[model samples]
Target: MWRDPGAPADSFYEVRPECTDVPKSRFRIKAGKTLSARKWHAAFSPEGYLDIGKTLSRIHRGGIHPSIRGEVWEFLLGCYDPKSTFEEREEIRQQRRLKYAALKEECRHLFPLVGSGKFITAPVITEDGIPILDPLVLLETNTDNGVVVPPQDNNAGSTMAPSSTGANLEKVTDKRTIQWMLTLHQIGLDVNRTDRTLVFYEKKENLSKLWDILAVYARIDTDVGYGQGGSLTE
Candidate 1:
């Protein structure tokens, strides 16, 4: 998960003074009670900011239970603003979803091969319902003939000529879009090779989700590019 758009970058690591205001006795999770939604609401200030020191102290004292760990970690990781009310947080979440969707759409447009599926075997279709063969397929078919097929357009019952040669294929010159595609390719390769032993990463859907998240982050923060690493560390 990404950091909250509203929070300072350093807020994630720095301890806030108010987080320690609670009495030590209240710091730990109550016996047998996990950090439930109700308790989390109680820990926030009326103005919306979470009492980070207090909340962290409580978590440190008792530790989060497994059942609520996913939800609780969202707050810990800055996915949600500690100061936000439930409704406000929900709105933020929705906005982030829309932003991510837009980024994914841009990625698909820039890289025709990119898709949100276990396997992108379907042919790419033009606006007028003509099916454009995947570039990989075209390349394989033309390997012996030495011809490169261009993206075909069949708008309103009209056909466009195929590109002359593979060597003359149109190249993406926009540095940003090219960098994004490169980052996307690297992420897929890394994800596939990094966690071969992990059952969770074995799932195609999980891999796709990881790719989508990294892609969205790359687009959101252009300064950060993909790095080579093992799957777990990545």
Candidate 2:
């Protein structure tokens, strides 16, 4: 006769690692006195190399101080190299900001719906090849009750015309550009659904920021494409 641990003797059983070595401290900073900037600098090496594991252990034990958590997160997230000095990190930050700005400018140039100051709007091509105004835009601009009034010049207008510089924006429907736009659109949809209960997510500007970051990532990592589920959840 076979021995049974608890359930019926014939029942099947499987075992898996419990991950006992992993830290179990709540992943949250403490309430009152948060980690200080000075303490943060001391946690890393003079060479700018951060002992992330050790630092995380400390955070797990004591929790981060609320005040310095934001700045500390930048270091934790690898936004700045742990081995870099304050001055070096600042320089890196400025360079990254400029790079991200340039990417946003490029995105705006390619997609008119982007950077249009209307966060909820998207480009919709009608049967006549003319773009229709987004319903959200209509909601804001139209005083009428849920009635959408089409623009006067439904036919191809100056907005749809080729640029004065002779750049045939409409004709340039390259494969890569189309893919990027599709990825961006999917990212926008994901952002809207992400953390919907959070007050910050309620603002369109915050959602726009999420979309921009995801779009830039998609542009850089063409192989990965746009991911759903857990990719946007965090």
lDDT of 2: 0.53
Question: Which residue ranges in model 1 land beyond 4 Å of their true spot?
Answer: 1-51, 118-168, 230-234
* Cα deviation of 80, candidate 1, in Å: 2.4
- List model 1 lDDT by residue over 1-234, tens digit each: 853222122222233354544222222334434455566667777766677777787676556644466677888888987777877987898998888778767754444333444322223333333334567545422323233333334222221123445433343434565455445556666666644544556677877677666656676688766666624543
TM-score of each model, in listed order: 0.57, 0.58
What candidate 2 gets wrong by more than 4 Å, as runs, is 1-53, 60-70, 120-172, 230-234
- The lDDT, on a scale of 0 to 1, for candidate 1 is 0.53
**lDDT, each prediction:** 0.53, 0.53
Q: Give the per-residue lDDT digits (tens) of candidate 2, residues 1-234.
A: 853222221111121244234333343343322354566667777656677776777676565664566777887777877667767987888999998888777765455444443333343334343334565533432222222232334333322221222122232234565566545545666777775644556677777777767766676678986797523544
TM match of model 1 to true structure = 0.57
